[model samples]
Target: MIDSHAHLYYEKFDEDRDQVVLRAREAGVVRVINIGTDVATSEKSLELAKRYMGFYATVGLHPTTKVVDLLRDIALLETLAKANPDRVVGVGEIGLDYYWKDVAPAAQKESLAAQLDLARRLGLPVVYHCRDALEDLFAFLQQERIQPPGVFHCFSGGPSDAERALALGYHVSFAGNVTYPGAVNLQAALQVVPVEKLLLETDCPFLAPQPVRGKRNEPAHVGHTRDFIAKSKGIDPGELERITEATTVSLFGLS
Candidate 1:
């Protein structure tokens, strides 16, 4: 299975990074895509990819980072994208987050636009981080600023939203939140997403699946999410694994 979204290089896994990776491998997670939220973390992700065999990286400036200097962020991400073409697969964890509207949506829009442009120029898929503000997010996406296809990570929208994203040539990725008992809306949305455009992720050290909720998530826990998605889609776990693995590899252009 391909864990398309993970933050394995974060300090949360510093204590037992090796053990965590081993557990994930033993759990049958064949590859882990480590994502970056900034230039520093992007470099760290590249370094980790070099050190690990079944690991890859996605470099971009997360909107929440408040990187208003769009040009600088784009320049840095472009440099990294060129420096490690093989290691870097996507441009992401990038998008607007109005959850904290107190920070003004302008900055988020600026950063998202710049990064989307960078992704188009680099010809890399995107890993979007859309939290709340679905209408605004959809508006920007509809504006046609980006060309390459991508996925919306931790999708919290409804069925219509999922359809819209797919129409826009974006895949919908489910984090552990989909397994929560009260997430009826999310479950319904998941049902509408086509299997071909579906991907599984842990968003680790963050959204641990049920039974492991409130705990530090890891790539190994992606199996739980895979099980959840399979059950939701009325397909077997093995089939879910096969489809998601293929979709992830196709999205990242990984062999």
Candidate 2:
């Protein structure tokens, strides 16, 4: 299995980051993509990817933070990607985050557009981090003609949103949130997401799935999310795992 998305570089695992990777390997997680939310984290992600054989990284400046100099950060990301093409698989966790409201909506849109353009120019897939701004995100994608291959990480929209995303040739990734009892909308979206476009993620150390909810998440716990999604789609867990692993590998060009 592949974790598709995680932040193992986060400080949450500072004390035993190696142990976390070991646990993920023991748990049958073959690969993990440590996402970058800023320039510092992007560097850390690449370091971890180099340290671990099956680990990979994505470089981007998340829109949730105040990007003091968007152009500089974008240049930094480009430099990182160019320097480590093998380890840096994509450009992301970049998108609008209306839930935080710390950054202005206009700024978020601008950053997202620039990053999307960067991903296209880099010839890499994207890992989108959208929250409470799907409409505007879709609008920006349409207006900018940004149709790069990517995944809508931790998707929280309805079936229509999933349909639109699939129509746009973007895979929809679900995280631990999909296991929540109240995630009816996500469940509905999952039902419509064809197995070919389904991707599983942990989004750790953030949304831990049931049986371990409320705890710091890790790549090893991706199985719980996979099981939940399999049951929701009425398929065998192993089959779901196989399909998602293939989708992740193909999408990210994992070796």
Candidate 3:
């Protein structure tokens, strides 16, 4: 399995980060994409990617972050990403989020616009993060300012969102949240998305599967989500793994 989105650089794993990677390997999650939300963490992701085999990194400014100088910030992110072509695979975990309402909507859009333009200019795919702003998220996506073949990571939408994402030539990745008992809408959207267009992620340090709920998530717990998705779709677990793995690798160009 490939954990398509993870923040192994997070302080939560500071003590046991190496062990977490080993646990992921033991659980058969061979390839991981360490996502970036800010300039510092993005550099850390590149450093960690170099330190670990089968690990890749992404560079982007997440919506939650304060949007200072959009152009300068995005330019720095682009420089960091371009400096490590061998390590950087995508531009993301960047998108709109209205959940907190603290970060001004205009600021989020400004950052998102700059980053989306950066992704297009860099010729890299994007990994999106949306929260309580799918409506505006879809609006930005439809504008075609960003490149194609990005992913809506940790998708929190219904069947209509999945369909629209597919229409836009983007993928929808489900994290451990799909295993929640109350994720009826997510489950239904899962059914709507063809396995070929699907990707799986742990989004670790968050969204631990039901079996390990209320715990700090690690890449190892991704299997629980995978197994749950397989069972929910009534397909062979191995087959699901193969398909998701292929789709993830092809999308991210991960080795």
Candidate 4:
């Protein structure tokens, strides 16, 4: 399994970073995409990628950093991507996040458009972040005809939203949230998305799965999320692994 998105470079794992990664591998996670939220994090992700064989990186400016120049940040990201084409698998952890009050909808829309353009230019799929703005996100993606294909990381939307995203050629990634007790709605949506378009992620240093809820999450916990989904869908864990692994590799061009 590939932890499609995680933030290992974050200080939360500073105490035992190496052990964290080792645990992930021991849990059967083959690769992890350490996503960057800004220029500094992007650089950190690149540095980590250079050192770890089981890790990859994606460069982009997240929506929350609204005041930053989209073109400039993306230009910098492009330079980073060009510097190491083989290591940078996708252009993302980028998109709208209105749930965070710091970013306005207009800025989020503009940033999303620019980043989508960058992904298209790089010929890479995107790893999107949508929060409290599905309709706006859908409109912009449709307007731009965004078709590079990607996944909605930690998707918190309903069945209709999942359908729209899949229709737009995106895989829907489920995170620890699906294991939450009141997340029946999200689980319902997850059921609707075909296994081929389903991906698994931990979004680590964040959304911890059941039995570890509210605690800081890490890549090793991805298996718990997968197990929950497998049980929910009445399938075996190995089948879920095969399906999610294939979906991730196809989406990110992973070997």
Candidate 5:
């Protein structure tokens, strides 16, 4: 299985990062995409991608990060992607997040637009993170004409949101939160996501699945999410794994 999104470079895994990767391999997670939230973390992700065989990296600035000079940061992301075309798989973990009003909505929109433009210029896919700003995100995408060969990571939206994302040519990735007993909206969204556009992720060191909730998540725990999604969809777990794995590989251009 491919853990389509993870933050394996976070300090949470500092003590035993290698062991965590080993565990993921043992758990049948053949590939992991280490996502970036800012310049520093993006560089760290690149390093980890270089160090690990089945690991890939993405570069982007999270909406919540203070952007004193958005142009400079976007340029830095471009430089990184150009420098490591093989290792940098996409442009992502980038999108609107109104969950925390710390950053101005205008700035978040600006950063998202600039980054999307960068991805288009580079001929790379994207990994989006939308939280409490689905309406605004959809509006922006509609206005900008950004046809995504990308994904909506950790999707918690309703069926309409899933439909719109699918219409935009983006994959919908579910994470551990989908396993929560109370996640009715996610379940509804999952039902609308066709098998061809489905992807599974851990978003590790963050949203750990049930049976391991409240614990620091790792790539290995992706199996729990895969199993839950398969059960929710009433499909065989092995078949679900095969379909999602193929979708992930095709979306991210993984080897």
Candidate 6:
């Protein structure tokens, strides 16, 4: 199994980060792609990837924060990607996040389009973040027609939204939230999406699965989400693991 999205560089794992990595390995998760929202975290993720064998990182600007200088930030991010080609496998965890007010929708669109262009030019996949802005996201994607289609990380939508993502040629990643009792809509969406396009993530230290809900989520708990998904979809756990892992590897060009 692989955690397609994580924030291990976050301070939540500061005290026992190594232990967390060990726990993930012990739980059978072989690779983890630590996503970056900004420049500093991107660097931190690359550093984390260097210390861990099966870990990797990505560099891109997130829209949740203010875009102080878009061009300058993209240039730095591009430099990071070029300087560490092997470590930086993709470009993102980048996209619109209307849930926060720090960056307005216009800025979010601008930043997302820039990063999307970056991924296109680099010939790398993208990891998108969409919250309360799926319509705008779908619209932008429809117009942009990106190459090497990316993922919709932590997807939170209905079957229609899943259809939209599928139509956009993007993988739909599920986090622990899908195990929630109130996630019937998400469950329905999951049913429609083919297993080949399905990816799983922890998105920790947040959205722990139902079994560990309200606690700090970690990669070790990814299996819980995986198990729930497999059972929900009537797929063998082992089969689901193998297929999703291959999908992740193919999408990110992971070793």
Residue-level lDDT of model 6, residues 131-237, one tens digit each, is: 98899988888887545578999998899999999988889999999999999999998998899999989999999999999999999999999999999889999
- Quote the positional error of residue 24 for candidate 6 in Å: 0.4
Locate the minimum summed-lDDT window of 10 residues in model 5: 140-149
- Model 3, position 252, has a per-residue lDDT of 78
TM-score, every prediction: 0.97, 0.98, 0.97, 0.97, 0.98, 0.98
In angstroms, give how far residue 23 of model 4 lies from its true place. Answer: 0.8
The residue pairs that clash in candidate 3, if any, are none
Q: In candidate 1, residue 173 scores what lDDT? A: 93
Residues 104-207 of candidate 3: C-alpha lDDT, one tens digit per residue = 98888888777777887778889999999998988877886445568999999999988988888889889998999999999999998888888989999999
Candidates by lDDT, descending order:
2, 5, 6, 3, 1, 4
Question: Candidate 4 has what TM-score?
Answer: 0.97
Residue 203 CA error for candidate 1 (Å)?
0.3
Q: Which consecutive 10 residues in model 1 have the weakest lDDT in total?
A: 95-104
Q: lDDT for model 3, please.
A: 0.89
The candidate with the higher TM-score, 3 or 5, is 5
Whole-model lDDT values for every prediction = 0.88, 0.91, 0.89, 0.87, 0.91, 0.91
User: What lDDT, from 0 to 1, does candidate 6 have?
Assistant: 0.91
Write down the lDDT that model 4 would get.
0.87
lDDT of 1 by residue, 60-150 (tens): 8887785656688679879988988899999988888877664468878878877888888889999999888888988888987446799
lDDT of 2 by residue, 117-226 (tens): 99999999999998899998888887766577999999989999999888888999999988899998989999999988999899999999987999999999999998
> Ten-residue segment with the worst summed lDDT in candidate 3?
140-149
lDDT of 5 by residue, 56-175 (tens): 999999889888889999999999999998889999889999999989999999999899999999888999999999989988988876565899999979999999998877889999
How many Å off is the CA of 197 in candidate 3? 0.7
The count of backbone overlaps in candidate 3 is 0
